[model samples]
Target: MIPPEVPLDDEELVTRAQAGDLEAYELLVARHTASAYRTAILLGAGADAEDMVQEAFVKGYRKLSRYRGDASFRSWLLAIVANETRNLHRSRDRRTGLVLRAARAAPYSEAAEDGAVDAALAGERRATLVQALRSLPERDREVIVCRYFLDLSEDETVAMLGWARGTVKSRTSRALVKLRGLLDVEELSRG
Candidate 1:
Protein backbone atom coordinates (compact mmCIF):
# COMPACT_ATOMS: atom_id res chain seq x y z
CA MET A 1 0.00 0.00 0.00
CA ILE A 2 1.13 3.55 -0.76
CA PRO A 3 1.79 5.88 2.17
CA PRO A 4 -0.06 9.20 2.43
CA GLU A 5 1.86 12.23 1.28
CA VAL A 6 3.31 14.23 4.15
CA PRO A 7 2.92 17.96 4.38
CA LEU A 8 6.00 20.06 4.01
CA ASP A 9 7.28 22.27 6.81
CA ASP A 10 6.92 26.04 6.44
CA GLU A 11 10.66 26.43 5.89
CA GLU A 12 10.53 24.14 2.90
CA LEU A 13 7.37 25.73 1.60
CA VAL A 14 8.92 29.17 1.97
CA THR A 15 12.05 28.07 0.19
CA ARG A 16 9.95 26.72 -2.63
CA ALA A 17 7.91 29.92 -2.71
CA GLN A 18 11.03 32.03 -2.86
CA ALA A 19 11.95 30.07 -5.91
CA GLY A 20 8.75 31.25 -7.61
CA ASP A 21 6.52 28.27 -6.93
CA LEU A 22 3.00 29.67 -6.64
CA GLU A 23 1.64 26.41 -5.28
CA ALA A 24 4.14 26.50 -2.46
CA TYR A 25 3.18 30.06 -1.65
CA GLU A 26 -0.45 29.07 -1.65
CA LEU A 27 0.32 26.27 0.74
CA LEU A 28 2.03 28.70 3.05
CA VAL A 29 -0.97 31.01 2.90
CA ALA A 30 -3.40 28.17 3.59
CA ARG A 31 -1.33 27.06 6.54
CA HIS A 32 -1.03 30.45 8.17
CA THR A 33 -4.19 32.34 7.21
CA ALA A 34 -5.92 31.77 10.55
CA SER A 35 -2.92 32.99 12.52
CA ALA A 36 -2.54 35.93 10.17
CA TYR A 37 -6.18 36.84 10.45
CA ARG A 38 -6.16 36.64 14.22
CA THR A 39 -3.01 38.72 14.41
CA ALA A 40 -4.57 41.33 12.17
CA ILE A 41 -7.73 41.49 14.28
CA LEU A 42 -5.92 41.64 17.59
CA LEU A 43 -3.54 44.28 16.28
CA GLY A 44 -6.43 46.68 15.63
CA ALA A 45 -7.46 45.80 12.10
CA GLY A 46 -10.74 44.61 13.66
CA ALA A 47 -13.44 44.67 10.99
CA ASP A 48 -10.79 45.02 8.34
CA ALA A 49 -8.84 42.02 9.54
CA GLU A 50 -9.65 39.91 6.51
CA ASP A 51 -8.56 42.59 4.10
CA MET A 52 -5.42 43.27 6.09
CA VAL A 53 -4.54 39.59 6.17
CA GLN A 54 -4.99 39.24 2.43
CA GLU A 55 -2.77 42.23 1.82
CA ALA A 56 -0.18 40.92 4.23
CA PHE A 57 -0.03 37.54 2.50
CA VAL A 58 0.40 39.17 -0.88
CA LYS A 59 3.16 41.35 0.43
CA GLY A 60 4.78 38.40 2.13
CA TYR A 61 4.78 36.49 -1.12
CA ARG A 62 6.32 39.37 -3.01
CA LYS A 63 8.96 39.83 -0.36
CA LEU A 64 9.79 36.19 0.20
CA SER A 65 13.27 36.67 -1.23
CA ARG A 66 14.08 39.05 1.56
CA TYR A 67 13.07 36.66 4.31
CA ARG A 68 16.24 35.79 6.19
CA GLY A 69 14.78 32.89 8.17
CA ASP A 70 16.26 34.27 11.39
CA ALA A 71 12.87 33.63 12.90
CA SER A 72 10.42 30.84 12.22
CA PHE A 73 8.27 31.41 9.15
CA ARG A 74 5.19 31.86 11.32
CA SER A 75 6.93 34.55 13.32
CA TRP A 76 8.16 36.25 10.20
CA LEU A 77 4.72 36.11 8.64
CA LEU A 78 3.17 37.48 11.85
CA ALA A 79 5.51 40.46 11.72
CA ILE A 80 4.30 41.13 8.21
CA VAL A 81 0.72 40.86 9.44
CA ALA A 82 1.51 43.36 12.19
CA ASN A 83 3.06 45.79 9.73
CA GLU A 84 0.09 45.48 7.41
CA THR A 85 -2.28 46.22 10.29
CA ARG A 86 -0.25 49.28 11.27
CA ASN A 87 -0.30 50.46 7.69
CA LEU A 88 -4.07 50.07 7.63
CA HIS A 89 -4.37 52.22 10.77
CA ARG A 90 -2.11 54.85 9.23
CA SER A 91 -4.03 54.83 5.95
CA ARG A 92 -7.14 55.70 7.91
CA ASP A 93 -5.28 58.63 9.57
CA ARG A 94 -5.95 56.98 12.96
CA ARG A 95 -9.24 58.87 13.29
CA THR A 96 -11.62 55.91 13.03
CA GLY A 97 -12.34 53.47 15.86
CA LEU A 98 -12.08 49.75 15.21
CA VAL A 99 -15.42 47.93 15.11
CA LEU A 100 -15.42 44.37 16.25
CA ARG A 101 -17.41 43.20 13.26
CA ALA A 102 -19.33 40.45 15.02
CA ALA A 103 -20.60 42.72 17.74
CA ARG A 104 -21.81 45.24 15.21
CA ALA A 105 -23.72 42.56 13.32
CA ALA A 106 -25.20 40.62 16.23
CA PRO A 107 -28.36 42.62 16.96
CA TYR A 108 -31.34 40.93 15.31
CA SER A 109 -34.47 42.34 16.92
CA GLU A 110 -36.38 45.47 15.91
CA ALA A 111 -34.67 48.76 16.74
CA ALA A 112 -37.17 49.46 19.54
CA GLU A 113 -36.58 46.13 21.26
CA ASP A 114 -34.37 45.56 24.34
CA GLY A 115 -32.04 43.46 22.21
CA ALA A 116 -31.09 46.54 20.21
CA VAL A 117 -30.15 48.44 23.36
CA ASP A 118 -28.17 45.50 24.70
CA ALA A 119 -26.36 45.15 21.42
CA ALA A 120 -25.58 48.82 21.28
CA LEU A 121 -24.21 48.79 24.79
CA ALA A 122 -22.17 45.70 24.05
CA GLY A 123 -20.70 47.29 20.95
CA GLU A 124 -19.85 50.46 22.82
CA ARG A 125 -18.15 48.47 25.52
CA ARG A 126 -16.17 46.47 22.96
CA ALA A 127 -15.15 49.61 21.09
CA THR A 128 -14.10 51.33 24.30
CA LEU A 129 -12.07 48.28 25.28
CA VAL A 130 -10.49 48.05 21.84
CA GLN A 131 -9.63 51.73 21.98
CA ALA A 132 -8.11 51.27 25.41
CA LEU A 133 -6.18 48.30 24.10
CA ARG A 134 -4.98 50.31 21.12
CA SER A 135 -3.78 53.05 23.47
CA LEU A 136 -1.26 50.66 24.96
CA PRO A 137 2.36 50.73 23.83
CA GLU A 138 3.05 48.27 21.04
CA ARG A 139 4.85 45.76 23.23
CA ASP A 140 2.19 45.94 25.89
CA ARG A 141 -0.56 45.50 23.35
CA GLU A 142 1.18 42.51 21.80
CA VAL A 143 1.62 40.90 25.19
CA ILE A 144 -1.99 41.52 26.10
CA VAL A 145 -3.23 40.13 22.80
CA CYS A 146 -1.12 37.01 23.10
CA ARG A 147 -2.09 36.40 26.71
CA TYR A 148 -5.64 37.62 27.19
CA PHE A 149 -7.12 38.28 23.77
CA LEU A 150 -5.60 35.32 21.99
CA ASP A 151 -5.54 33.24 25.16
CA LEU A 152 -2.17 31.72 24.45
CA SER A 153 -0.53 30.02 27.39
CA GLU A 154 2.67 31.44 28.79
CA ASP A 155 4.83 28.95 26.94
CA GLU A 156 3.01 29.56 23.68
CA THR A 157 3.16 33.31 24.28
CA VAL A 158 6.87 33.10 24.90
CA ALA A 159 7.41 31.19 21.66
CA MET A 160 5.13 33.45 19.63
CA LEU A 161 6.58 36.72 20.95
CA GLY A 162 10.13 35.38 21.07
CA TRP A 163 10.37 36.64 24.64
CA ALA A 164 11.81 34.93 27.68
CA ARG A 165 9.26 33.35 30.00
CA GLY A 166 10.08 35.86 32.77
CA THR A 167 9.76 38.71 30.31
CA VAL A 168 6.33 37.49 29.27
CA LYS A 169 5.23 37.27 32.91
CA SER A 170 6.40 40.79 33.78
CA ARG A 171 5.09 42.33 30.60
CA THR A 172 1.69 40.69 30.93
CA SER A 173 1.41 42.01 34.48
CA ARG A 174 2.51 45.51 33.51
CA ALA A 175 0.31 45.66 30.41
CA LEU A 176 -2.79 44.64 32.34
CA VAL A 177 -2.24 47.48 34.82
CA LYS A 178 -1.88 49.99 32.03
CA LEU A 179 -4.98 48.69 30.24
CA ARG A 180 -6.99 48.93 33.45
CA GLY A 181 -5.87 52.51 33.96
CA LEU A 182 -6.81 53.43 30.42
CA LEU A 183 -10.26 51.85 30.74
CA ASP A 184 -10.79 53.59 34.06
CA VAL A 185 -9.82 56.94 32.59
CA GLU A 186 -12.16 56.39 29.68
CA GLU A 187 -15.04 55.65 32.04
CA LEU A 188 -14.35 58.69 34.18
CA SER A 189 -14.08 61.01 31.20
CA ARG A 190 -17.28 59.72 29.63
CA GLY A 191 -19.19 60.83 32.73
Candidate 2:
Protein backbone atom coordinates (compact mmCIF):
# COMPACT_ATOMS: atom_id res chain seq x y z
CA MET A 1 0.00 0.00 0.00
CA ILE A 2 1.18 3.59 -0.63
CA PRO A 3 2.01 5.70 2.43
CA PRO A 4 -0.20 8.71 3.13
CA GLU A 5 0.84 11.74 1.12
CA VAL A 6 2.93 14.34 2.92
CA PRO A 7 2.00 17.96 2.69
CA LEU A 8 4.14 20.04 0.36
CA ASP A 9 6.06 23.09 1.57
CA ASP A 10 5.60 26.50 -0.07
CA GLU A 11 8.46 26.15 -2.54
CA GLU A 12 7.11 22.85 -3.84
CA LEU A 13 3.61 24.27 -3.95
CA VAL A 14 4.87 27.38 -5.74
CA THR A 15 6.70 25.30 -8.30
CA ARG A 16 3.60 23.24 -8.97
CA ALA A 17 1.40 26.35 -9.11
CA GLN A 18 3.81 28.03 -11.48
CA ALA A 19 3.50 25.00 -13.73
CA GLY A 20 -0.29 25.40 -13.89
CA ASP A 21 -1.43 23.52 -10.81
CA LEU A 22 -4.50 25.37 -9.52
CA GLU A 23 -4.84 23.12 -6.50
CA ALA A 24 -1.33 23.98 -5.36
CA TYR A 25 -2.07 27.66 -5.69
CA GLU A 26 -5.31 27.26 -3.76
CA LEU A 27 -3.39 25.57 -0.97
CA LEU A 28 -0.97 28.46 -0.92
CA VAL A 29 -3.91 30.87 -0.63
CA ALA A 30 -5.41 28.87 2.23
CA ARG A 31 -2.08 28.78 4.05
CA HIS A 32 -1.49 32.50 3.81
CA THR A 33 -4.93 34.12 3.85
CA ALA A 34 -4.80 35.12 7.50
CA SER A 35 -1.34 36.59 7.23
CA ALA A 36 -2.28 38.44 4.09
CA TYR A 37 -5.39 39.82 5.73
CA ARG A 38 -3.45 40.91 8.80
CA THR A 39 -0.86 42.59 6.64
CA ALA A 40 -3.59 44.43 4.78
CA ILE A 41 -5.28 45.70 7.93
CA LEU A 42 -1.99 46.73 9.51
CA LEU A 43 -0.91 48.53 6.41
CA GLY A 44 -4.15 50.58 6.33
CA ALA A 45 -6.39 48.75 3.91
CA GLY A 46 -8.92 49.38 6.73
CA ALA A 47 -12.44 48.20 5.87
CA ASP A 48 -11.24 47.11 2.44
CA ALA A 49 -8.68 44.65 3.81
CA GLU A 50 -10.49 41.48 2.71
CA ASP A 51 -10.96 42.69 -0.82
CA MET A 52 -7.35 43.73 -0.90
CA VAL A 53 -6.24 40.22 0.09
CA GLN A 54 -8.25 38.72 -2.74
CA GLU A 55 -6.70 41.13 -5.21
CA ALA A 56 -3.24 40.39 -3.87
CA PHE A 57 -3.77 36.64 -4.25
CA VAL A 58 -5.00 37.05 -7.78
CA LYS A 59 -2.08 39.29 -8.58
CA GLY A 60 0.30 36.82 -6.98
CA TYR A 61 -1.04 33.96 -9.12
CA ARG A 62 -0.75 35.97 -12.31
CA LYS A 63 2.76 37.02 -11.43
CA LEU A 64 3.90 33.57 -10.35
CA SER A 65 6.38 33.44 -13.20
CA ARG A 66 8.01 36.59 -11.90
CA TYR A 67 8.42 35.29 -8.36
CA ARG A 68 12.13 34.48 -8.16
CA GLY A 69 11.93 32.79 -4.72
CA ASP A 70 14.40 35.30 -3.30
CA ALA A 71 12.07 35.65 -0.29
CA SER A 72 9.81 33.40 1.73
CA PHE A 73 6.44 32.87 0.09
CA ARG A 74 4.72 34.64 2.99
CA SER A 75 6.88 37.74 2.65
CA TRP A 76 6.56 37.70 -1.12
CA LEU A 77 2.79 37.49 -0.86
CA LEU A 78 2.81 40.24 1.77
CA ALA A 79 4.76 42.48 -0.58
CA ILE A 80 1.85 42.01 -2.92
CA VAL A 81 -0.61 42.71 -0.13
CA ALA A 82 1.30 45.86 0.82
CA ASN A 83 1.45 47.07 -2.74
CA GLU A 84 -2.23 46.36 -3.29
CA THR A 85 -3.20 48.18 -0.12
CA ARG A 86 -1.12 51.17 -1.11
CA ASN A 87 -2.78 51.16 -4.48
CA LEU A 88 -6.18 51.13 -2.83
CA HIS A 89 -5.29 54.24 -0.84
CA ARG A 90 -3.77 55.94 -3.84
CA SER A 91 -6.87 55.33 -5.92
CA ARG A 92 -8.77 57.48 -3.47
CA ASP A 93 -7.41 60.99 -2.71
CA ARG A 94 -3.92 61.69 -3.98
CA ARG A 95 -3.57 64.49 -1.41
CA THR A 96 -4.08 62.05 1.50
CA GLY A 97 -2.21 59.13 -0.04
CA LEU A 98 -0.44 56.30 1.81
CA VAL A 99 -1.80 57.00 5.28
CA LEU A 100 -0.32 54.02 7.16
CA ARG A 101 -2.66 53.30 10.05
CA ALA A 102 -1.34 50.82 12.57
CA ALA A 103 -3.89 48.17 13.46
CA ARG A 104 -5.72 49.59 16.50
CA ALA A 105 -6.65 46.11 17.73
CA ALA A 106 -3.01 45.17 18.31
CA PRO A 107 -0.98 47.50 20.58
CA TYR A 108 2.04 45.48 21.43
CA SER A 109 -0.63 42.93 22.15
CA GLU A 110 -1.27 41.64 25.51
CA ALA A 111 -2.81 42.02 22.81
CA ALA A 112 -3.74 44.76 25.24
CA GLU A 113 -4.78 42.63 28.24
CA ASP A 114 -5.60 43.51 31.87
CA GLY A 115 -8.18 44.01 34.70
CA ALA A 116 -10.87 46.70 34.55
CA VAL A 117 -8.67 49.63 35.48
CA ASP A 118 -5.60 48.06 33.97
CA ALA A 119 -7.54 47.34 30.80
CA ALA A 120 -8.72 50.93 30.60
CA LEU A 121 -5.20 52.18 31.02
CA ALA A 122 -3.91 49.65 28.48
CA GLY A 123 -6.51 50.73 25.97
CA GLU A 124 -5.58 54.37 26.38
CA ARG A 125 -1.91 53.56 25.99
CA ARG A 126 -2.67 51.52 22.89
CA ALA A 127 -4.70 54.34 21.42
CA THR A 128 -1.87 56.74 22.05
CA LEU A 129 0.59 54.48 20.34
CA VAL A 130 -1.72 53.93 17.40
CA GLN A 131 -2.20 57.67 16.99
CA ALA A 132 1.53 58.18 17.14
CA LEU A 133 2.05 55.49 14.49
CA ARG A 134 -0.50 57.14 12.26
CA SER A 135 1.42 60.41 12.49
CA LEU A 136 4.75 58.87 11.42
CA PRO A 137 6.04 59.41 7.89
CA GLU A 138 4.83 56.61 5.65
CA ARG A 139 8.13 54.71 5.43
CA ASP A 140 8.79 55.08 9.15
CA ARG A 141 5.39 53.58 9.94
CA GLU A 142 5.93 50.74 7.46
CA VAL A 143 9.15 49.46 9.00
CA ILE A 144 7.79 49.74 12.55
CA VAL A 145 4.64 47.85 11.65
CA CYS A 146 6.50 45.14 9.72
CA ARG A 147 9.27 44.60 12.24
CA TYR A 148 7.38 44.95 15.53
CA PHE A 149 3.59 44.83 15.12
CA LEU A 150 3.69 42.09 12.48
CA ASP A 151 6.64 40.30 14.05
CA LEU A 152 8.50 39.98 10.76
CA SER A 153 12.28 39.52 10.85
CA GLU A 154 14.84 41.96 9.46
CA ASP A 155 15.27 39.91 6.29
CA GLU A 156 11.54 39.26 5.89
CA THR A 157 10.87 42.99 6.22
CA VAL A 158 13.52 43.68 3.59
CA ALA A 159 11.79 41.32 1.19
CA MET A 160 8.29 42.55 1.98
CA LEU A 161 9.20 46.23 1.59
CA GLY A 162 11.55 45.63 -1.39
CA TRP A 163 14.29 47.49 0.43
CA ALA A 164 17.93 46.63 1.00
CA ARG A 165 18.48 45.04 4.43
CA GLY A 166 20.44 48.07 5.61
CA THR A 167 17.55 50.34 4.74
CA VAL A 168 15.31 48.30 6.97
CA LYS A 169 17.83 48.53 9.80
CA SER A 170 18.26 52.28 9.59
CA ARG A 171 14.56 52.99 9.13
CA THR A 172 13.64 50.76 12.05
CA SER A 173 16.13 52.56 14.29
CA ARG A 174 14.85 55.99 13.27
CA ALA A 175 11.22 54.93 13.50
CA LEU A 176 11.71 53.54 16.99
CA VAL A 177 13.34 56.75 18.06
CA LYS A 178 10.50 58.82 16.66
CA LEU A 179 7.90 56.50 18.16
CA ARG A 180 9.53 56.80 21.59
CA GLY A 181 9.60 60.54 21.32
CA LEU A 182 5.94 60.61 20.54
CA LEU A 183 5.10 58.27 23.40
CA ASP A 184 7.14 60.38 25.76
CA VAL A 185 5.28 63.50 24.75
CA GLU A 186 1.99 61.70 25.18
CA GLU A 187 3.02 60.59 28.65
CA LEU A 188 4.14 64.05 29.60
CA SER A 189 0.83 65.49 28.48
CA ARG A 190 -1.00 62.88 30.52
CA GLY A 191 0.96 63.73 33.66
- Number of the top-ranking candidate, with lDDT as the measure: 2
Instruction: Give the per-residue lDDT digits (tens) of candidate 2, residues 62-181.
Output: 999999888999999999999998888789755221223434444434633556777777777767877888778889988988998689999899999999998999999999999899
Worst 10 residues of 2 by lDDT: 95-104
After superposition, the stretches of candidate 2 with alpha carbons farther than 4 Å from their true spots are 1-5, 94-113
Give the Å error, residue 145, model 1: 1.1
Runs in model 1 deviating more than 4 A are 95-139, 151-170, 180-191
lDDT of all predictions? 0.78, 0.86
The TM-score of predicted model 1 comes to 0.67
- lDDT score for residue 50 of model 2: 93
Q: What is the lDDT of candidate 2?
A: 0.86
Whole-model lDDT, model 1: 0.78
